[model samples]
Target: MLRELASILGLFRQPPQDASGGDRTLVAQLVGLLVEVRAAARSNKDFTTADRIRDRLSQLGIVLEDRPNGTDWSWD
Candidate 1:
């Protein structure tokens, strides 16, 4: 299922000709924020906060799933 979704998104994942360092930095920052929030929720054992974070990401077109190993996230 995820492979199919990735294939679909691949059609839209064109490389930017003039990408800058800032783009990578911004992406790193957002990922860091997500990790921090996830850690906090886990530390507090607050599933509600974790669910809210997942739902918010969903609203932004990202899907977050809690798997047996850990949490997985993807964007569409």
Candidate 2:
């Protein structure tokens, strides 16, 4: 778990490489899909899924905020 956390942190330091054509759109769609997955996991009481998502996002330099009403996510 510690190693995974370290690996995820390392991923955040690197930016996505420049892509051509439809790659940008694809990336956006993928991100959206991941967000939905995270939401579903939370609804299903699958915190393992949520935590994995958060950890993965953290690797990408993304942070998740847990609020009483809902969750908010952002990247740095």
Candidate 3:
């Protein structure tokens, strides 16, 4: 599943392990990683790559909002 996630965004970042099935933490690691990759692309001035990543996440129902501070996302 992790390998497939790399394929999903053409980015190679491992999903954080969820210890206790919750990581004793916050959001889904995979979603977080995807957002990170998108941000990195935008930072590199690669809007095309960023857009592709955003579109892929949207396909999975993850909607992203661009903010001056950063990007936020949600889905229904």
Predicted candidate 1 versus true structure: per-residue lDDT over 8-41, tens digit per residue = 6442243333335665455445644675687689
Per-candidate Cα lDDT values, in order, are: 0.58, 0.65, 0.67
Error of 2 at 19 (Å): 3.9
Ranking by TM-score: 3, 2, 1
lDDT at residue 12 of model 2 (Cα atoms): 26
Per-prediction RMSD in angstroms? 9.9, 5.9, 6.5
Give the worst 10-residue stretch by lDDT in candidate 3: 11-20
- Clashes by residue pair, model 3: none
Looking at model 3, residue 47 earns an lDDT score of 94
Q: 9-44 in candidate 3: lDDT tens per residue?
A: 443233334234454233456667778888998999
The global Cα lDDT (0 to 1) of model 2 is 0.65
Model 3: per-residue Cα lDDT at residue 19: 36
Better of 1 and 3 by TM-score: 3
Question: Which model is ahead, 2 or 3, in terms of lDDT?
Answer: 3
lDDT measured at residue 45 in model 2 versus the true structure, 0 to 100: 96
**lDDT at 18, model 1:** 36
